[model samples]
Target chain A: GAGVSQSPSNKVTEKGKDVELRCDPISGHTALYWYRQSLGQGLEFLIYFQGNSAPDKSGLPSDRFSAERTGGSVSTLTIQRTQQEDSAVYLCASSNAGGSTQQYFGPGTRLTVT
Target chain B: EDKVVQSPLSLVVHEGDTVTLNCSYEVTNFRSLLWYKQEKKAPTFLFMLTSSGIEKKSGRLSSILDKKELFSILNITATQTGDSAIYLCAVLFSNTGKLIFGQGTTLQVKP
Candidate 1:
């Protein structure tokens, strides 16, 4: 892909139901990240992956929120037993490397937990 | 806790008016500061400042970081209606890809 891509541009789910958002990062990129943007708010760091393992899961928000990347290409963010507060836009980004490099972002998945 | 704060949560301006957006941060480790412009969906990258006093310019948009003051400012000259968007500021960790973002400034450029 020319840039990062995310799935299900818009998603609406009932409270307590689980949801999965997907991201396909640019090829050969070694770093992938997930962020949550609430209404009128900035991007909130959720998780980061280097290769297939996530070194920094410090921002996962809660145990119910988990993300994994396989083949260093595609990643999935799963929200278990979603709450109304989980409604937000989930953004995914990929960089050639981590840190100092600029990250390319996806269109983002708008998750609405009713 | 790392924190990034942006001022003037919202702004209204006319075309051709120059605007300056402010960002200040409190972080344990500061590698670089980045600016992003978001219109509808995703945020597009603008500028990344690592050295203090050096300005990164792209057309009418320029940004400079001040490590001493722990702040950065983005200036848009002769703004256009297309410039109406949410301007975001983020601080990057030196060794990781994690970015701590500010609340963002919503700029409305009136025609």
Candidate 2:
């Protein structure tokens, strides 16, 4: 079984630039989540999608951050206007339909806002 | 405001020594507690505790949760150098299914 996968392993962008990070969940995982880990800090929840339900955006820091899951398998997290504080490793994780299951994580995408 | 906290933000120990990491949380509708080990970009799931007093064990690692006190403890017996990594604790909310994580504990094991 293929694990979760993320794209653009590392990205260096100038401040104010918009960046989109992609995540491909496991073949049948119905619950997907996005998290951000700043340097020397814990992972901060970003967003979550479960099946066809409305996505949970409470964890998103601001309007500049948004995410969408298409076809229930892939998700994209967009940071509209990047700031130096936005520089962090963005991690994607997925689990079975039941949220109680342990999530499988992917090799995160490191975004560096210059 | 729901939050999770880990004690001894950083620890140093020699191989073969036993160590215990602590996690205390204040969250509403707590469903389960999880433990993860991160040596790199990806974090590997270690344990998920849902019941109080029941210990989950794997190899040299074990964890116990206390719902009464709203805390959990992860213990490693006869630690190895490979155990040097960041240990993260997270609490899952039953209502939203989102995990609130603690600022992980960094462990350094010397050979």
Candidate 3:
């Protein structure tokens, strides 16, 4: 793809429901990132994937938040027992190199937990 | 913890007016600073400044980095309505490949 791509542009789920968001990064990009943005708030880093190394999950908010990158290309973010506060736009970005590389973002997935 | 701060949370300007957005950061092992323009959805890249005292420009948009001051400024000359968007600033940490972003400055240009 020419740029990063995300699935389910919008999702509305009830409380306690689980939701999965997918991301497809640009070809040959080795680094990928996931971020969450609440209404009127800045982006919050969630996770980062670099090659086959263990993902940097330091930013994951809680145990209910988990993500996985397959083949180092496509990634999935899963939220278990979603809460109303979990409603936000989930953004995915990818970069060609590791450090100081420019990131290209995908049209985020807007999740609304009712 | 790395932190990035942007001033003037929101601004409203008329077309052809010039505007400057500010960003400051405190990060360990700072490597680069990036600016992005975000509309309703995805954020589009604008400029990336690595070296101090150097300026990056594209069309009516220009940005300069001052490593000594730990800050950067984005300037838009003769702005247009299309230029209205949230301007975001981010700093990349060396080796860690982590990018910490500041709360964006929202610009609204009226025609």
Candidate 4:
């Protein structure tokens, strides 16, 4: 893909329901990252994947938040038993390398937990 | 803990006016600072400052980093209504490949 792409641009779910958001990173990019933006808040780091290495899950806010990247190309963010506070824009980005490399972001999925 | 702070949480400016947004950070092993522009959805990358005192320019936008001061500034000269958006600052830590973002400065440009 020319840029990072996300699925289901918008999602509305009832509290306690599980929701999955997907991201397809650009071809050949080795680094993928997920971030959450709450209402009037900054981007919060969620997780990152690099090749087949153990993902850096230090940013996952709670046990209910989980993510996985397969084949280093696509990634999914899952929230179990979602809460109203989970309503926010979930963003995904990928970089050719990492650190100082520029990250390309996808059109985020706006999740509205009711 | 790593942290990034942006000033002037929100600003309202008239078209043709100049504005400056500030971002300061405290992090371990800082590698680079990035500037992004956010409208309704995605945040588009603008500039990445790696070295100190070097200015990066794009059209009416310019940014400079002061590593010694642990801060960076984004400046817009002769702004337009199209420039109305939230400006975000993020710092990338060395070896970690993680980004810590500031709360962002919301700029509202009126014609």
Candidate 5:
């Protein structure tokens, strides 16, 4: 596609339930990133994948949050045992070379854990 | 501690008015500073500044970064109602390839 794309624009799940947010980065983009936007907090980085290098999961808030990039094209963010504090917008961005370049963002998925 | 900080958390301006948003960060490994305009869903890329003193402009929007000062400013001239949105600032850390973002500045351009 022309730009990054995400699925399930809106999600409402009960506490302790699991949810998966998907992201399809732009073609040939080598760097993909996941971030979350909350009411007061800024866009907090969650994880990133660059080429075949080990993903930088240092930003992940907890062990329940995990992300995987398949074939270096598409990515999925899985949140297990969702909590109400987890309600926020999950955004995905892709850059051409790495984080140094401009990133294209996808319409985020608004996840509401009730 | 927030590595990135933005000023004037929210602002209201009338059409044709110009506004300047501020962002400052404390990162030694900063690779670049980026600006984004976000509406209801996602953010749209605006500009990326890598060097100091050079300004990047797009239409009525312009941004300049000062690496030595560890700060940046985004200027929006001749603002329109359509320009109402949240403006975000982020600094990319080269070492970890992680971006530290600031609490956005919400601008409301009224007609």
Candidate 6:
């Protein structure tokens, strides 16, 4: 089976622009997650979706960060007014359930905000 | 606030040497701890520890968790050049599915 996958492996955008990153979770996975890794920093949790509903969005940094999942399979993370500090690798992961199983990761989308 | 910390931000070792990576965390309702090896964009899962004082082993890698101490250690025995990569430690709490990750430890195993 195909593992978790994300689109736009690399993206470079000017600051103040908006960017939408897409993610396709594994088949039959009910839980999806979004995280970002900044330069010289660890992975930071952004948001999590259980089915089509988002139950835990506390990790979102600010109002510019928002994520939505459709049909409980695909998700999109939108960053509004991207800032230079937003440059990082956005990773997507999925699991069978909320937090009981091991989550599989995707190759990630590296966003460079210039 | 929940936080995870790893020691020895970077390490250099030769092949056949043994290395130990440490992770300590502070979180509410801690459920389990996980270890991952990241060489590229994707991070591969290594182990998940839920019980304290129990060691999980696979190949040359082994990890043990200490709930009382709020820390865990990942030991790689007979390390090879292929072992060079960034090791990440994350803690999963009972509240949500979000994982709190530590600043990874970069290991360099020279041949």
- Candidate DockQ scores, in order: 0.93, 0.76, 0.80, 0.89, 0.79, 0.88
Q: Cα lDDT of all candidates, in order?
A: 0.94, 0.93, 0.93, 0.94, 0.92, 0.94
lDDT of 4 by residue, B10-95 (tens): 99999999999999999989999999999988899999999999999999999999999999999999999999999999999898
lDDT of 4 at B14: 99
Runs of candidate 6 exceeding 4 Å displacement: none
Relative to the real complex, the DockQ score for model 1 comes to 0.93
Complex DockQ, candidate 3:
0.80
Query: Clash pairs of candidate 4?
Result: none
| Candidate 3 lDDT tens digits, A1-114 | 378899999999999999999999999999999999999878888999999888889899999999999888999999999999999999999998877689999999999999
* TM-score per candidate: 0.98, 0.99, 0.98, 0.98, 0.96, 0.98
* Interface root-mean-square deviation, each candidate: 0.7, 1.0, 1.0, 0.8, 1.4, 0.7
Interface RMSD for model 1 amounts to: 0.7
What's every prediction's RMSD, in angstroms?
0.9, 0.7, 0.9, 0.8, 1.2, 0.8
Query: What is residue A47's positional error in candidate 6, in angstroms?
Result: 0.1
**lDDT (10s digit) by residue, model 2, range B6-57:** 9989999999999999999999899999999999999999999999999999
Q: Of the pair 2 and 3, which is ahead by DockQ? A: 3
Mind giving the per-residue lDDT tens digits that candidate 5 earns over B3-110? 999998999999999999999999778889999999887789899899999999999999999988899999999999999999999998878668889999999999
Error of 6 at A6 (Å): 0.4
lDDT of 1 by residue, B5-81 (tens): 99989999999999999999999878999999999988999999999999999999999999999999999999999
Q: List clashing residue pairs in candidate 6.
A: none
Worst 10 residues of 6 chain B by lDDT: B91-100
Clashing pairs in 2: none
Top model by DockQ, which number?
1
